[model samples]
Target: MEARTGREKQVYKKGSIRQVAGCVPVNKTTKKILLITRRKKKGGWMLPKGGWENDESEQEAAIRETYEEAGARGKVTSLIGVWDHNVINKKTGLPKATFSFFEMEVEKLEEKWPEMDERDRQWFAYEDALKVLIKPFMREVVEKCSLAPSNKRSKKEFSESNINKNLKDTWNLKFSAIVVFFAFLIWYLIKDNKFISILT
Candidate 1:
């Protein structure tokens, strides 16, 4: 697939904040996040993100960015949130771009990609992935994923385990109360023989 290049037909040339779409690609089983090398200066790892054309939605743009940059794609999930930051674009002056980052549970990583000649991709452990990133907003995306339980399968399992523990505790407490009530009844019968005799 050919990568979309240049400032071709992007949204918000007139608007104040330019809207960019991004993806946080993760492998749930390996618990790793995918990061790609910067094609130009700065020469550090970052998430896959870029501007979409006028026609497609932000989600579609995000998925496209992921595949184009990282050569990875999968189930494109929830939007983590929108992040706003300034960019020193020569053409646009000092306008900020708000990136709508989404989480993608990556299923496929290609051997060759459209921009493979310019960029390289690798997978990193969740926390380590956050450390390698230079952009604050990109890090924010990973951090948001870390805190969001629904995004991770392990988090969902933890939640289920917690619920089971709570139920077990409740059952134990009820059992103890029943045992205590029976003990009190037996003790009262022994202490007051006249009460037991009247019952008989």
Candidate 2:
């Protein structure tokens, strides 16, 4: 689907606050979040956000933005709260946009998305995400995102996360074992024959 680029259907709040919706797309474990690069790689990286359209609720708009900008589909719970910030001539000019950021548990990731050419997407550990976020409002969204696992993910996804984590741990253990074995072999080759007698 084509992303909505024009503000014709945008939802404005009060008189000047432009309503914007975005999401902190994350794995079921909430260990990492998905971020999208700025169109020109100017803002570094940011949560998938855009104008809240007139036809959709804040939540719907947020999820839509996640799919369009981050190429993620997932489940989001209630509001993670909202913040209001002013835009300063990077893209949307000087209008103030009121934002509602959701904590989304990503379920499906598409290889091709509407904004694929416009942006690049990646998953980052929560702490790393904070470092690349250029906007203060976006940082606030990360800070407010719940890190506690909800344990609400579908069994299949939850198992997948566990399996992935286990595999990583197993690899680390094997790597460490190899390093230790090589170190011992080197030490044996250099040590005096007296030290070898203890092991024999």
Error of 2 at 75 (Å): 0.8
TM-score of 1: 0.70
Each model's lDDT: 0.84, 0.83
Query: What's model 2's lDDT at 79?
Result: 78
Cα RMSD of all models vs. native, in order, equals 6.1, 16.1
Winning model by lDDT? 1
Runs of candidate 2 exceeding 4 Å displacement: 86-95, 148-200
List the pairs of residues colliding in candidate 1: none
Those runs of model 1 whose alpha carbons end farther than 4 Å from true positions after fitting are 40-42, 87-95, 146-200
The residue-level lDDT of candidate 1 at 47 comes to 92
Q: What tens digits encode model 1's per-residue C-alpha lDDT throughout 1-200?
A: 78998776788645656789988998888888999999842479999999977889889999999998889979886888987665656776756677889999999998888788788888999778878998877887898884344456787898999999999999999999999999998888879895679788
Model 2, span 1-200: residue lDDT tens? 68878989989865667898999888856489899999855559989998998889989999999999888999996577788685544555555777888888899999888989889888898779889987987887787776533333455687999999999999999999999998897788658674567658
| TM-scores of the candidates in the order shown | 0.70, 0.67
